[model samples]
Target: MEEEITFTVPIRPDMELEVTRVASSVAEAMRLGKDKIDEIKLALIEACLNAFEHSKSKEKKVHIKIKMTDDRLEIIVRDYGVGFDPSKVKEPKIEEKLKSPRKRGWGLKIMRSLMDSVVINSHKGGTKIIMTKRR
Candidate 1:
């Protein structure tokens, strides 16, 4: 996390492509394997999706940071959205989520399963989700 790759994009559905693009660029520059690249991209997608789906800023913007090192890849997804209580995003059971009416809320769970580390910070100003995958 000493040096970071960063991007700032509108927290909107249309900006999801930019999320993939930013992550993919870092993945390729690091020579990540295909599987890792996909995983990283998906991780970023989940993060961006969370922001896009939840943030309420007038401009609808989110900021992201990616840091890679010999040991792992660290990603930070932050959104200026309506904040939520991180303590309460109960891990969605896949089976339950599949059967539920909401049919969503799986992003956090998926990200947690794929990344070695997952951390969420939220306040009135914004929400931040941080994930790291071991290399």
Candidate 2:
């Protein structure tokens, strides 16, 4: 059997916590391991924060969808904002980050590292991130 939950949140402060609460409940219900649930929560936070800080969405909202099966979980995070080119983003290097004043830009890398799979779809209108993990 497959189960799904969908929700939308405004691009406001602390909204990511609300999303994480829902995610935690769903993951617990699915009996996901603690480490896996933590990873999911962290990745979801990064995705939501990116939308909140960078999406520049006129609607100022983020959309999330989670699909769960017997042995798999899939999450989608989306924002209707000015999209960015992933290819154009430079890979963050530790040395450069240490030297640079801005200590950010690790969201994509972190999400990919934590999730079993991550696919990004971004155009001029919006960006969508699809991430999955297997039990």
**Which structure among the candidates has the greatest lDDT?**
2
Error of 2 at 66 (Å): 0.7
Tens digits of per-residue lDDT, candidate 2, 1-135, equal 999999999988999999999988999999999999999999999989988998899999999999999988899999999999989988988899999998889999999999999899999899999989898
For candidate 1, what is the lDDT?
0.81
**What Cα-based lDDT does every candidate model obtain?**
0.81, 0.93
Let me know the TM-score candidate 1 reaches against the reference structure: 0.87
What TM-score does each of the candidates earn?
0.87, 0.97
Worst 10 residues of 2 by lDDT: 85-94
- Candidate 1 residue lDDT tens string, 1-135: 356888789755568778778787877877778888888778778888888887776667889888888777889998877878877887777688777888778888788887788999988888899899777
Query: RMSD to native for every prediction?
Result: 1.9, 0.8
lDDT of 2: 0.93
